[model samples]
Target: MPASIHAAASGSPTRADGRASFQKARRRASVQALLLALPLIVFLLSTFIAPIALLLARSVENKEVPASMPALSRALDAWDGRGVPDEYIFALLATGLRDAQQSGQLGTVARRLNFAQPEFRSLLMRTARSVRDETPPAWKPALIELDERWNAPETWRLLKRAAASPTPDYLLAAVDAQVTPQGNVAFVADNASIYRQAFLRTIAISASVTLLCLVLGYPVAWLLANLPATSSNRLMLFVIVPFWTSLLVRTTAWYVLLQPGGVINGVLMGLGLASHPLPLIFNRTGVLIGMTHVLLPYMILAIFSVMKGVSPVYVRAAQSLGAHPFTAFVRIYIPQTLPGVGAGCFLVFVLALGYYITPALLGGAGDEMISQLIALQTNTQLNWGLAGALSAYLVIFTAIFYFLFNRIVGIDRLRFG
Candidate 1:
């Protein structure tokens, strides 16, 4: 064989070496990226995604009671709430309550399970007391007679409800929905449908605020975009100065500023602009005003950042061609600022939807947002399932908003800087 042919056959390869080297480099780069991304991925999962996933899970977290008292749950599972629960059911409740009390977690369990019915505590307390006394099964009649409320249908219903794993009762009640009289599918009561109304009010308020911010912020952004650099910078500082103060302080300040006897009305009365003080604070007007003030900066910043990058030459060229200033602005400049408008509107709307302290403190009962009700359920009513479900719905809505925004307006076109 020739020397060259021998060398080729001996695997003095050229193409294979290049391919092998490229694959090795690609693999190393991929490994490096994965290593660099690991901490951030873990941090995001733990802090952001994990909590939200847990919250979503809590929407269905009805297993606490049933899991804690599995034997009781099984005993009550077949027993309907039509009449007094059987002796086995009572014994199960007694055992579970004793266990819960011993663990010092009865309060937490009671708070969660109470959402099914209000009279759970008395039943639990009575059962816990009697069961610890080593009373015979025949003493059940005496126990029933001790508190006849124990024999009530609703009381049994409450127990039977708690006995089930993954009850949807609290989640339904959050929206004012509940199981039918037959304990079948859930139904919403006409008068108790406050959640739907509150949901609509939230959407409407958010939309109105977004519109107000756009109308107010657009002109300001245009002015900033057109102004001398120093003047624009000074104005931007004033716009962003609100960020220096705490949100709570800003909201409280609005309450003070808009209250009937506060600065605005005081000045109005003093100037004889009005004979009587206007009802400004503690209403929808106050909510819109305070929210707009706080959110306007977001709108302005979003718009101004995008506007800063827009070329002024388009407008100038249009004007030079004898186009009117308004025409030039509308034709040449407005289209370019749309991405900012959409982005700012979306940001403001989502923020408004989740607003709590501002509306709670500054607005009246009529103007209360869904978040206030969620807080009420979680704190005052001690309805964790409902709170969790409400939060889940809010998260779902936010995701939908993001999806729609991404679909309708390319997020890539929306400027952040």
Candidate 2:
């Protein structure tokens, strides 16, 4: 081969080798980066992601009936919903109840059934006692004799619904709706419809608190941004100090301050602003005050951070061009601080949505939020499924608000420092 051809061929192989070497180096770097991130990935999956997955799973989980009454659940799956199940199913039910009662699983099954219909728990317990105490020749008649509800088609349908695993019943009930015996989706009775109103109250409170924070925090943030460094730093402490205090302590302080005979009401009555002590604590007014006070620091810091980066020249120039000071501030300065406003509002609103201790301490029964209901289900009722469902709805609402905020204000532009 000629020298030129040999040189060209050698150069091609050299370039190819360079390309391969580059690819190998890139792959090695990628592996190193992944190794560095592996711990964090594992931590997130174990702590955050896994727990959320479990919560979502628990929302639809209906294992109480199927696990405790396996035979009855399986037999009910085959039965049509026209009327009460056959005598064979009744026999399975009696056997299952006896086994469950003996195994100490009857309470779990009864509790799960009661969630579907309030009276089912007592009915099941009464029948289970009868089944355990006596051996009936025909379980259908014996169960019917024990409770007339056993003969009702609606009772059978409720049991069948509860028997199915991975059910929507909990989720439906979370929204104050339910699946009827006829397999139709319907709102619960007016008296039973609480979750929907709770959800609305939660959103309403969150929005109100966010608005209050913004209204109260904006001027303070502007002052902090405009003041000398020494003055601003001293003033910033006022905002930061409360933030450093424990949340429970802060809420408790507010609880004392806003009570009927506390400082606020005392001041008002002393000043002759009111004839008597006001109903400040344990109402919507107290909830808003407590939440706004707690969240104000966040709003002020977010806006101040953004304002620090914004030049004063813009507003000055606008004012020099014959605009009033307030007009210049609104038209020039306010728009520049919008990213911070968005960040602060979103943060405060989301935080307010999940507030438990503050509201529980300060607000009354009528002002109960969704978090209160979730706690009631989990702690008082021992209904993890309902709690999970409520949490799922809260998560969904947060996600929706996040997307809406992202779309309207652009999440990329949000500035929180």
Candidate 3:
């Protein structure tokens, strides 16, 4: 009592000073922890984040045409797109083309433009070749005389648009949309569209694979959970052994089985189930089978893990309470299995979205997915812009799907059963 009264009289707060010291200590510890992690953070940024960021930025940055024809790109900036360009615009183009042609880069400009409007490459190549030796007195008339396409205001407008830096043309084209001559977004004609169809096929195939994994894996998971440990372990070895095998090897095995003269067909034919071998490989059926087989283990494992934890007592109690066996199983057991179901579906769907080798090796021309299309652009056509755009689109789709799935199923609670 005397110490309390004396402390109150002195009015020196002990807790405040201790708190200040504690906070200072905490700050020092935090700094030390950050310093320890700094190298890992820098490494990730340099190796992973930096490259991904650069690729994503390339999807929207367009410099090919503008870089080749700087003078024309600058001059056309002022020319109204309403009618045929003024002499100044033509003069700029004539000189720019001559300079670019001499530098052997005019073809590059033309190639970039041709992606926006067909036949532009030939138009530009012919014009540049004809005028390479002559300095025309009147550039506008010379250009128009060389090619009637030069007279169209739409052509000039398109040229101007194409040379504008950081264009949307490539990004738009990735999704089957185009920047029209009138400066508007329009979908490419149905026949010319490839991205939209590829995206649809990817989604359809992924959804089908997810559904197949769920339908096929759930029963196996339940059986494993109910079986003796020894038997369950042996069965699980079968499920997991596929993972130990090479993906290429597994796909090839499926190919052999699904092929016309392959094992499955041979058996069916010998059993008189069909008159001839079925058309399975090199089609959607082959794509589905390969994807499902590769991904089914993940579903089984996820469900089996969760089911292992669920108590049989709950089902017994519900049955003892006068519920039928099916009702008890459905009401008491299934509700507890939801987390496993969500986890399995989420994993299977996400994996299926990125599947490449199986589809490429097993499926036919029409079964090509977005990843293959991106690869075709990146490798075959060497169109990095389109490839980057498609990648960005896929990333966006995956992120959106993830967000929606998380919202609906509470991914945080989706324990890996």
Candidate 4:
């Protein structure tokens, strides 16, 4: 063979080995990069994803009684609600309470059962105290003598429920529904139906705030986008300055201002806008005012960011084409700002849903949002399951709202402004 052909044949295998080595080296680098990121991925999974999963699980999980009083819980599982559970079930409960009292699990089981029945905490506590030193009792009346709750079929139902796993009771209660005597769901008594009303109030307030923010912020954002740089810079400070104060302080400030005798009413009265102080505080009006004030900046910033990108020349061109000033602005300018409007509304609405301190400070019991109820269930009632249920409800609400809004407005249309 010619010298050139021989050289070419020899070079081919050499190039092939070089290419294979390069591919191996690239694979090794990718593996190293993934290994470097592994710790962060694990950390996020542990801290963020795991806790959220646990919270959602707690909303449905009902293992507290079973884990604490397994013998009693298991015995009650076979119960039919046609009558109060048999005395043997009560006998198992007595033994369990005595053991729980000794083992210090009595209060835990009591509180868990209380979420289902009104007086279970007292019932369990009283029984635990009486049963602490007693032997297993087959005497049903004696157990009933210790507590009248043992005589009620409803109490038995509550205990039977406590023995269950992954129940929908808390979820139903989130919407002001409850399991009936025959194991059917029904509305809670009208007097006690607070959650449905609270949810409606929350949705109404959030929507109102979102609308108000969009309306008020649009004008300010437009002015900011159109104004001289120095003027816009000065005006932007008004939006940014509130962040310097703590959210609690800002909310408290609004509380003081919106109260009947506060600065706002004082000003209105001095100007003779009203003959007397308006009932602005501790109601729906006060909640709207505080939430709008606090959340206005987010809307303004979102819209302003987008509006700044829109050239006024578009409106000018429309006017040059013989469109009236109002028509030009409406047809050309407003259409372009729709993305910003959607962004502002979505941001404000979702943020407003989770606001706790603002509404709690400014709103009455009737005006309270779902977040306040979640906090009440978590803190005062010590009902983690109910709290988790409320949290899950809000999460699901926000997610639905987001997806629906995105479908209508297009998430791709969302802009920083």
Candidate 5:
């Protein structure tokens, strides 16, 4: 071989070896990075992601009837839902009810059924009590004799729906709609409807609070951005101090201050601004006040962070070129501060949507928000399925707002101090 060809072949192998070593090093670095992130990924999966997944599953879960009365549930699978099931299915239901009652699982089935139709729980309980000991010779007539509702095709359809392993009933009810006996989606009666109104009320209150925070925090943020560093740092303490206090404490403090005989009403009365104490507590005003106070700091900090980075020269140049100071500030400074405003508004609004403590304590029945209803379903009603459905909707709303914010303002540009 020629000396030059041998030299080139040797150099090519050396270059190939160096490239392989570089690739190996890069793979090692990537593995190390992944290993470092493993704990955080596992923690998130277990705590946040898993719980959300479970909640979504729970929303559609219809295990109560199937788990408690398996035979009846199995029979229900064969039901066409056109009319009541045949005598054989009725016989199975009787046996299933007897077994469920003996096992103390009848209540679970009844409760699940009652979510589909309000009178179902009472009907099931009455029938179970009647048939607890006796095996009816003819279950079809015996059940109908026990309760006229048993003869209704609608009743059987509702039962079939509740017996299914996974159902949309809870999810539909969460939005103030339901599946009819005819298997059609329809809104509930006006008087019976609540969730849709509650959702709208929640959105309205959150938007109101976001607007209030922006109005109150903007000037403060501008001041912080413009002041000397020492002065600004001192002023920032006012915004940060509230965060150090527990959220509940701040809400409770507002609860005390906004009452009929509270400091705010007292002051107004003493100043002769009002002849009597105003109804501040247990109203929408109190909810707005409490939420705005809690969220104002977030708005201020977000705006201030962006403002701190903004040069003063733009507004100054506009003013120096014969633009009015107010005009220059609005036209130049405000436009630059919008990313922060968007961040602050999105943060405050999303937070306010899930607010329970402030609204529950401060607002009246008319001012009730969706969070209160979720708490009601979980704590008061013991209806996990309904609560999960409500939570699913809230998550969806948050996600929708997040996408809208990202589209309009670019979430990547957001600043939070």
Candidate 6:
């Protein structure tokens, strides 16, 4: 065979070994990459995905008592509305309470029922006490006398209603409901429909703040984006200076500045600007001022970041083409900055929707956001189910906003800008 042909057919032994070794190294690198991603995958699954899933579950978790006490649910399933419940129904309640106590979820079961009928907690406690204190033979009669109508089919019906689970029953009530037995629908009582209103009000206030930020930040960002690097750096220090202080400090500073006797009023008085102190703090005006100050930087940063990428040549070119300054900016310059506008709007809007501290400090009764109500439910009422449900709804609202924002303006546009 020719030397070249022989070399091609046999290959070099060292070259073959080198190729095999390279394949092994590549396989090892692939395994290393997979290993490195494993922790992050696990962390996201556990901390982010898992908790959100559980929270969503809690928002609709209604079946615990009924599932545990199937026999009671079945026994009560047939009865008419006239008579007292029988021994089987008592057995179901006893079983449900025992299982609830065992699972350490009696509290959860109790609270759901509490929303339907506030006396449910006391009923659960009494039933638990009755089960512990009285002998088995006396259980039915004693419980009947404790509430003689307890034997009535309506009483058992209420228990079954509380026992229904994995349903939107909680969501129904979260929005305010008088849920009916025959249908899944609820009638929203005119007086009790606060949640829907609160949700709307929250969205409105958030949008207002976002608009204020846009109106106020646009000029500032435009100026900053046009300045010399040193001037821009010095100007940004004013924005960043607030970050160095605690959020509470910034909020409190607004309180002092806006208060009747504070610096702002003093200055106005000195300047003969007003005869009386302005009602600035502890109201809607105060909330607007404080939130606009707090969230303005986000707007500025978003706008400035996008503005930096926009070439001045575009405006110059437009002018060179016989466009006036305003026309060039509006027709050419402004379109280029829409991505930034969308980003800053999304950021400020989302932040403002969940705003708790600034609103709580500055807003009066009418201006309280949903976050404040969630806090009240969790802390004051100790109603975790309601709080959890509210949180779930808030997350849903935020997700809806994010989805719409992404649809209206792609996330890529925001990120690249």
Who wins the TM-score comparison? 5
**Candidate 3 wrong stretches, greater than 4 Å:** 1-13, 17-39, 189-192, 411-417
Report each candidate's C-alpha RMSD, comma-separated, in the order given.
3.9, 3.1, 3.3, 3.8, 2.9, 4.4
Query: Where is the poorest 10-residue window by lDDT in model 3?
Result: 408-417
lDDT of every model, 2 decimals: 0.81, 0.89, 0.86, 0.85, 0.90, 0.80
In order of TM-score, best first, we have: 5, 2, 3, 4, 1, 6
Q: Is candidate 2 or candidate 3 better by lDDT?
A: 2
- Residue-level lDDT of model 3, residues 1-417, one tens digit each, is 576567767986566667999999999999999999999999999999998888778788778777888877877776777889877888888778888988888877876777777799898888887777787788889889889999998888888887776877777888899767767789977787889989998999999999999999999999999999999888888998998999999999998899999999999999999899899899999999999999999999998999999999989998888999999887778878877887898889988988899999999999999999888887887777888898888889889888776665664355322
lDDT of 4: 0.85
Candidate 3 positional error at 31, Å: 4.4
| Per-candidate clash tally | 0, 0, 2, 4, 0, 5
Q: Which has the higher TM-score value, candidate number 2 or candidate number 4? A: 2
- Candidate 1, clashing residue pairs? none
Q: Estimate each model's TM-score.
A: 0.85, 0.91, 0.89, 0.87, 0.93, 0.83
Tell me which of candidates 1 and 2 scores higher on TM-score.
2
Give me the runs in candidate 1 sitting further than 4 Å from their true place.
Answer: 1-16, 78-86, 98-106, 139-144, 147-154, 186-190, 316-324, 411-417
What residue runs in model 5 are displaced by over 4 Å at the alpha carbon?
1-19, 411-417
lDDT of 3 at 102: 88
Tell me the lDDT of candidate 3: 0.86
Estimate the lDDT of model 1: 0.81
Write the residue-wise lDDT of candidate 2 on 101-196 in tens digits: 999999999988877779888888888888888997888888888788889998888888889988998899898888876678999676767999
**Shift in Å, residue 84, candidate 3:** 1.6
Tens digits of per-residue lDDT for model 5, 1-417: 976678687775555667999999999999999999999999999999999899878999999988988888888898788877899989888888888989998888887787777899999889888888677679999999889999999888888888897888889989999887677999978777799989999999999999999999999999999999999999999999999999999999999999999999999999999999999989999999999999999999999999998998998999999999999988888888888898999999999999999998999989999989988988888889999999999999999999898666764344311
Worst 10 residues of 5 by lDDT: 408-417
